[model samples]
Target: MNVSLNEVEATAKRAARGAGYPWGLAEEVGKATRWLCAHGIDGTNSLAQLLEQGLAASLKNHRPVEMQSAWAGQGVLCPIITGALLSDRSDLLHAGPIRIQKLAVPVFLLPFVASAARAQNIVITHTCDLFRAATDGDRLEAGQDWPSFSDHTQITLGGQLTTPRPHVTRATPDPACWDTLNRFAHRTYAPATEESRLLGAGAGLSDND
Candidate 1:
């Protein structure tokens, strides 16, 4: 059955908690899965269905063997597990972007991608195309009209997107003025007067005997 995004998120969270994942991590998984689904990855829907159907047993058993088989015919990938794997394997995956196809619940996979990117100090570009190509260690150019998060079908490293340059320019404040202000503040303070010095603590006191 088709599921709504909210339902998918809630179900995924519940499943994550039931599966012994921390609440905070479960929450993150929910959001990450939602993002992936929104990007047309079917993450939310797949996760929700998995939760309702109690697919944890399959996942646990499959994890010990070929974890990828968990989603073999179900067309539902677990984003939480995938993300965790990515984070753990960041060192190995850092050389370049990696692509996986036929991922069920693909939306749930984004956090892993993001985390992996961060761990490797690279950027991850996700493409919805059949190839599901991701770019690592690249920079996005800033653009005048920024694209919406959902609009980005392809993921890239640091430079995948760019901010728009403002056409209107404003004059910068003068450095000389700042220097003058600093000089004035310094001048406002006077050397301690004799009277003030006399009253100062330890002015006439000495430790030397």
Candidate 2:
């Protein structure tokens, strides 16, 4: 069934939170998912797969660490965390390309790259064996081979502009994927109690002013 971008973002945020991410990161996840869905990508499925794979268990272990000339994670890197870092440190992109190893759900990184690109007023190109894409915060272009994950990822600033693409207002997620997301999101709700139910979703059941 088709859902509005707002619903997608809200569900994604709650799902991320329920999957053990803090509110701040979950908010980012929501925006990223909305961006992907708007651009014709299966973002809910990607996030569902990531969460289902137990990647969300210990996020700290997946953080990217700087080595001699590149960043490597102790385990596979969480794209949302790494992507947030990329947006936070966008200025470093000017010095040289940033190479990240063992990144999971690499497509999730595109939204953050777009944010970085918009901040720096330049188009950013992300290249790897699985995919090649360029974004300028608004326009986006990705290869047909863009996979769900990548072993190594590299991103460089200042690429040629891509054609403006129309964005969608509603997204049609896979039914199974939507159910998976909803299950995760269900954790965020407080259990309904008799007392609360009597209150009828407001301060009281009374209609009197």
Judged by TM-score, which candidate is best?
A: 2
* TM-score of each prediction: 0.43, 0.91
lDDT of 2 at 135: 91
Report residue 27 deviation for candidate 1 (angstroms).
4.8
Scored by CA lDDT, what does every candidate get? Answer: 0.45, 0.86
Give stretches of model 2 more than 4 Å off. 162-164, 201-209
Off by over 4 Å in 1: 1-12, 18-28, 31-46, 62-77, 97-102, 128-159, 162-209
Candidate 2, position 131, lDDT:
72
- Tens digits of lDDT, candidate 2, 59-169: 888888764488787898899999999999999898999998888888889999999999999999998775788999988887433676787789898777546456788
For this target, which candidate reaches the highest lDDT against the unseen true structure?
2
lDDT of 1: 0.45
lDDT of 2: 0.86
TM-score of 2: 0.91
